[model samples]
Target chain A: GIQVEQSPPDLILQEGANSTLRCNFSDSVNNLQWFHQNPWGQLINLFYIPSGTKQNGRLSATTVATERYSLLYISSSQTTDSGVYFCAVPKDGGSQGNLIFGKGTKLSVKP
Target chain B: SQTIHQWPATLVQPVGSPLSLECTVEGTSNPNLYWYRQAAGRGLQLLFYSVGIGQISSEVPQNLSASRPQDRQFILSSKKLLLSDSGFYLCAWRTGTITNYGYTFGSGTRLTVV
Candidate 1:
């Protein structure tokens, strides 16, 4: 089983500030995804980056597969972004769909 | 496009009562279904996954069980509930293939056992 650990278990920032979150995995992974869990308990897909980088609106993600780590970037954060951000990878590499999730980084954006 | 639906946005059950949560996927067939739980202030924990009808794999040993009676239906059931079972339960699904597809989660069911 692969272990996924996220950094800065808790984070707080002003509405206009920017921040970076990191996720480290113990083994190589073929699939990786980022999600934002809102206060209503909905998991919203943020990105699916097994390797390389992707950007969606004010948020972006970069996964360095060789290093077995991923980075999530938020620029000019909004108060609505307050929630838990989780990164998950396939429990077994390749076709296995079982995902191993990190504890997550709780972000609070104050207006 | 594919969509996942979960029932009973919220529930409150007695400790010894039974439990049943339903999840259904539409616009797709033979999709991989999963059940996950998140305790208060905790991360998502994989409880069960199914690749097809009548085929389920449990990731953790607990009082919970899952069943897939149809190609797009996944059910989570408990013969008797426990106070520790209180949490947010989510249902997710992805394409049934070996591609790099991401999962789509339902709105989740908030269950509180007393």
Candidate 2:
């Protein structure tokens, strides 16, 4: 079983501020993903980066598979971004396997 | 485009009541389905996953069970609920062979056992 730890368990930022969340995993992984769980409890897909770097609008994710960690960057945040961000990776070596999730980073963006 | 639908956005049940939560996927066939439970402000816990109809794998030992009667349908059931079962349950789906895309999650169901 792989263990995942997310840093800065809780965070609060003024609107328009930037922030970074980190996820560290205990084992090698072939599938890694970032998700945003909104206030209503819907897990929204943010990024699927098993390795390398990817950006989507104000959000970007970088995964250093060799180092066994990943980073998520939120640029110019907004109130709507107030929620829990989770990092998940497959327990096995491939995407077809089930995921082991980290507790997550709870973020609050204030206006 | 694929989508997942989960019913009964919220539920309140007695400790001994039976429970059933249904999830159905559309626009995709032979997709992988999963059930996850999350406690308040916590990460998700994988309960069950199905690769196809009638094939289910349980990740954790619990009173809850899952069934897939159709290619795109998944059901989570419990004979008698427990107070510990109170949490947010989510249904999600992803392409079995298309590994590049991340999973798509349903809106989720909030279950509270009194």
Model 2, span A1-111: residue lDDT tens: 789999999999999999999999999988788999988788898988989999999999999999999999999999999999999998776445578889999999999
Q: Write the per-residue lDDT of candidate 2 for residues B3-114, one digit (tens) a residue.
A: 7899889999999999999999999988889999998769799999998899999989999999999999999999999999999999999753556867889999999999
Backbone clash pairs for candidate 1 read none
Model 2 TM-score (2 dp): 0.97
lDDT of 1 by residue, B1-114 (tens): 788999989999999999999999999988988999999877899999998999999999999999999999999999999999999999999753477587899989999999
DockQ score of candidate 2?
0.82
Docking class of 1: high
Candidate 1's C-alpha runs over 4 A off are none
Q: Give the per-residue lDDT of model 1 (tens digit) for A1-111.
A: 789999999999999999999999999888889999987788988888989999999999999999999999999999999999999998866464888899999999999
Question: What lDDT does each candidate get?
Answer: 0.92, 0.92
Question: Stretches of candidate 2 above 4 Å error?
Answer: none
